[model samples]
Target: MALLVDELMTKQPRPLGRSLILCASALSVALVTGCTSDSGGPSASASSPGQQQKSPSNGSDLTDEKLGKQVEKTLDTAEVSDSDPLFVEAGLERVGDGFHSVPDLTRGHSYKLSVVCVGKGKISLSIAVKNPVRQTLDCDGVTFRQHLTSSAAAIKIDGDGMPGATGMVGWRLDKADK
Candidate 1:
């Protein structure tokens, strides 16, 4: 039977100073050893910090003119009507050879893309678009949400993850009839 630490420590007949020291030493060891390693599965992405830090690019670094043309194409393909404007920063951004580029708007603006009233105000804009990536919380739980932009009663959603899940969502105002 090894010495029962608790019994020995508490059954002290020593001076006040030594008893206090022994108690503190025990507590410190317990606290330090409390942390345990996790056995969860692997992480989502294994890309190193270097790759992650690399600025998002559209592949080919387009020149000013090429960038303009690419951005113009997005609006042309998108539901940007006369009533709504895709206000360009630096007039517009360039598209990468790869079909992607850094996001333009910083969120918090009134500008919109009409998708209902075609020709200039279409209601079939970007509602219900999926999110680019799914959002996740540290197990506490997170509400799924999609990116949304509104024009009048219409809304344009863009991105690419599942809707109504524990991730990002996407949806439009739904005014194709109007």
Candidate 2:
């Protein structure tokens, strides 16, 4: 009877020890996940004290009215004559890595492509045709223009922004007489 009683005591302790370990494991997991969870924490755009914060577009600066005005201004500044007609006037909204393509371009014609950002951010534009090219522009209300010697089937404009940035870009394409 003593032996039986001793055995029962020892087995009870084993289960109790297992239960303690299980509880500890569960607690550890909870702690780890709780720290990593996204509960409205500071995002990548957050900057430290005394650090210059970059102004990245968040899609609010380029409203429809604003974008339309910008496009009209750019076209006017481009001075498209009767010989050169406007091909495309577009507004692009980009977040992170985004692209816009200008389709149905004619070959062997002189073309001008212009882009400007309507908000606070930097936009990088690129042309993809027979040869690929790249350009970076600031959103300080300046228009960037590029002249194309040959017609391309499409012109690809790529927008690169900072982490968690959503910006608006306006573009115009003019076709020159052959």
Candidate 3:
């Protein structure tokens, strides 16, 4: 049995360390802006220390811009530089889901996908490309990244926020380092 298990492991070496690295990066970003329980409002603690706290949405007082800035920083940290010639899409939903599409991608080219979500509830994301990828993010906020080789002309991102989910979601796709 041990030999059989070893054979299987050799056949398919798990990306155990890669997964840990991703989780660590996410946690580090989340730590920068503490997370709070969803109570139908944004918490000042969620804002970066020393910065003016702003709610994601407050009727006349919309704060999506503020969250976008934070997500930008997260993306930059992940090496998805804004200066890069790439497809970038980001936005905030007061409540419910969000969607974005990037067309005219170079098929078969390697690309890096970076995503970050901040706010409340669970944000389920579906990246539809030649090879569809799905991920669930805690609205508390964190940056997650993945590498993919394009197999389609376009990529669609569908962020389905679980019931009562409210937050900002940002994504970037850039040419991966060879």
- In candidate 2, what are the lDDT values of residues 1-178, reduced to their tens digit? 9999988878755788999999999999999888755443445334455545555454454463465466457546434454544564444544343557655666677777777665556666778867788777676557888777554355565656544444456666666545
Itemize residue pairs with steric clashes in candidate 3: none
Candidate 3, after superposition: displacement of residue 15 in Å? 89
Best by TM-score: 3
* Candidate 2 segments whose C-alpha is farther than 4 A from its true place: 1-68, 76-89, 92-99, 151-154, 164-167
Output the worst ten-in-a-row residue range by lDDT, candidate 3: 87-96
Prediction RMSDs, each to the true structure: 16.5, 10.5, 24.5
C-alpha-based local distance difference test score of model 2 = 0.62
Worst 10 residues of 1 by lDDT: 116-125
lDDT of 2 at 170: 64
Q: List candidate 1 segments past 4 Å from native.
A: 1-14, 36-102, 105-178
lDDT of 3 at 17: 75
TM-score, each model?
Answer: 0.21, 0.49, 0.55
lDDT of 1 by residue, 12-73 (tens): 46688898998999998877655331222233233544334333243333333343343344
What is the alpha-carbon lDDT of model 3 when measured against the actual structure? 0.66
